[model samples]
Target: MFKYVIQLILGFLTLLMSTAISWYEGSGIIDNPLEWKYSTPFSQIFNIEISSGQDISQLDYFVYAAKFQPFFPTIMTVSVLYICTVLIFFIFQLNRQLAIILSGIISCVFIVMSAIFFNSSTVGGNIFFWITAVGALIFISMGISLWYRKKYMFKFQPQ
Candidate 1:
């Protein structure tokens, strides 16, 4: 439908905007070696030593932004999730049961992600933890509302 297309376009645009902003913000770390320790989680995890900006890959910029300055990266992640959710809802609009199941599964995944970030020491980790927790709640509510509407609000009446 036209509305679905609009929502999809808006979600994609939001994702692009967030990615660009996060990339710009993350690129700052390339100039400031002092921030390297805080920004190079990928390098640390992989045991890769980054002596200069060249040692950092383009993909690492996004990772840096995600760990150190998560606002826009979070937006990017949520936007991608929203686009996927919208597509799933559209695809399963006629199958309420399947939609409900998928919603529950998605919520569970978000819950786990939130828990993973729950004890993070960085500002970005704290923010992502709360965001993912909220996402889980949203998905749970969506499933409940769909189930309620299908079960209680659409009952047939005798003519």
Candidate 2:
């Protein structure tokens, strides 16, 4: 009974973590002008400059850039991939600690970096692009390790 209870708790926690991760992601953020006012600890983490006169509408969150843009999308993609991969492992009932540790690591990096740049009080601060980029790099590192282990293992996926 105790073991089952622990498993249940673990599963729920994992799901909750996944849910939170999903929420901050691109699909999660409800492109609201209000989200612009979040004044978070990681506010000024992203530094974007408005082009000469490009009138940016609220719905333009998917924008890459006006002057130097490709960087933002590339970083955001990392967050998506990291969270999606973690979700996949979770759904498969793989190692819970592995998933949690990996996810936490990603989360921590963003949190720390975000705190350092907190409260930019600028238009670009509304977008949390740096966190996303850092997240992707972290994910890529873990993914590579998993891939190498699988490729070299004589007996992968131990039962």
Candidate 3:
């Protein structure tokens, strides 16, 4: 339990730091005309024309950073995923079966996310694709190892 708390705190701190850095990097688009084109994913997707920096939503700043400069945004994404994974593991630690099921579900979700970015032409898309693909592999491996350890490593003795 103590370890879980520590992990959660560390994850949260990482998330906060990454978010701040990403936000700062993203906000640079407001001053750089060259970045305006790279920051238009939100506008393109939502069909909203952003003629000026003032028209960009706060959330779009994150998207801008993610699209042009993926490093900090990637860290932010990984941090959030880590926090969620830790919480899920802590919640279902006592129930191996449930944990395994949840792990599989999470892995599938990651797989889908990876696929979504698989064909993206942007640097962020490539980074996200790899991140999600690796995440799927990690979750699936965790689920498999847990199942194997529970089924093969433990012998039940009748009382």
Candidate 4:
């Protein structure tokens, strides 16, 4: 239980940190007034042109920003996966096998998502960095859970 709590806390911290980094970097969402220009393929395809002194903080901006790079999407996906895994562990009471299987699925998905950006011009290498870290964390947590399963079998107690 303590180990699971630590895993959850770590996941939450990573999610928060990644989100903060993305926001700080703007992921090309927030445009500067002095350097407002749109000459990329995304701009041409989406017909997006940011004018100087224009505030752009719409859902479209968020979506387009993600499309611009895999970093944001990868981090967000890992965050959601981490949350879901925690819920499955606590609420569903799934065994270690299921958790490990889910981790494998997540790894496959992460690989595909990261691969999609390999040929993209706008994709940042930071996505690869985060993906590696998230993958390691997921596997490590799963391994720890498996190792301690016999010692700490999680049971739902109605209180």
Candidate 5:
């Protein structure tokens, strides 16, 4: 019971940090107008100057940039992944095999979602991006560690 509670608390903490960092990174792009050109959702939110004499309308820019932008999609996917992982942890508490499988699914989804940012030149260097990735990894590590202990490391006390 104690171990389960500890694991649950830690898992929640990891997810919370991941979600917070993802949002932080997403919001940081708006700090610079030029950076917003790479994010359609952000472009739609704010008008950005392209050059000394030229400016782009958010809608017009979004129409051109939407097909290539992954920033918003990654944030949404990670949020959903966080919710699903938390549910898996709570619902599969008694089934180690089920928990492990679900954790793998959750980890894979996060990996793919995170992969969306690899091609992004701006996102790769953001501190919040690294923090978010680390937080998600911690969540996966906690789940795997719990599953391993339950499957192979259980101890029996002498009577």
Candidate 6:
């Protein structure tokens, strides 16, 4: 029971961390030793963009700035969330599974909302948003399925 609780907390944290994915757009790159930008000031100082083509397309530049930490935050958050999500599937209690499944639904809702704007947005924004949104949507769908199995598809008897 305690393990399940810990796993549930981790799962919730993962959901919260998922928002970090938004940070990738503004991920800054470096040109020369003196020339660089980053999602954060610290990233720029420690991370160097050595790519020959230092300039992103005008559209990509705008989108990247609009986002941030592409190389860091987004991946980190989603990764944490995914890890917790997997734990939730294998270990959480039925009631907690309900919350996790609901969270997945919420993620799906977020993606749908994003899709509405992505259609009218820039090419880069459109692509990134759609892919991430879809990923979130799929995760939620899978979670919901797992929850369904835990709830209605199985019967638990006391030992």
- Give me the candidate number with maximum TM-score: 3
* Position 104, candidate 6: lDDT: 75
Please provide TM-scores, in order, for all candidate models, with all chains considered together.
0.78, 0.30, 0.80, 0.46, 0.44, 0.42
TM value for model 4? 0.46
- Computed on alpha carbons, the lDDT of every model, listed in order, comes to 0.84, 0.44, 0.84, 0.57, 0.53, 0.51
Clashing pairs in 1: none
Candidate 4, run of 10 with poorest lDDT: 33-42
| Cα lDDT, model 5, residue 42 | 38
User: Over the stretch 39-125, how does candidate 4's per-residue lDDT look in tens digits?
Assistant: 233443556665532344443343444545557656766786777677557633556566656665665665665565455444444
Which clashing pairs does model 2 show? Answer: none
Q: In candidate 5, what are the lDDT values of residues 21-68, reduced to their tens digit?
A: 454444443345554455444344665545521254434332222233
Residue runs of model 6 more than 4 Å from their true location after superposition = 1-63, 66-77, 80-84, 94-97, 120-123, 152-159
User: Model 4 off-target regions past 4 Å?
Assistant: 32-94, 122-159
lDDT-based ranking: 3, 1, 4, 5, 6, 2
Off by over 4 Å in 3: 32-38, 44-47, 150-153, 156-159
The clash numbers for all candidates, in the given order, read 0, 0, 0, 0, 0, 8
lDDT of 6 at 20: 47
How far does residue 51 in candidate 4 sit from its true spot (Å)? 6.6
Which candidate would rank higher by lDDT, 4 or 5?
A: 4
How many steric clashes does model 5 contain?
0
Cα lDDT of model 6 by residue, 1-159, tens digit: 676567667756654554443433343432223323322344344454435434433233333543433433344445554655555555444566665665676577657756654764445445456656766776677777776766776477655
Of candidate 1, the 10-residue stretch with the lowest lDDT total is: 150-159
lDDT of 3 by residue, 1-159 (tens): 999999999999999999999999888677766766666667667776777777666677887788789999999979977986897678666787888888898899999989978988898989999999999998899889878876876576655
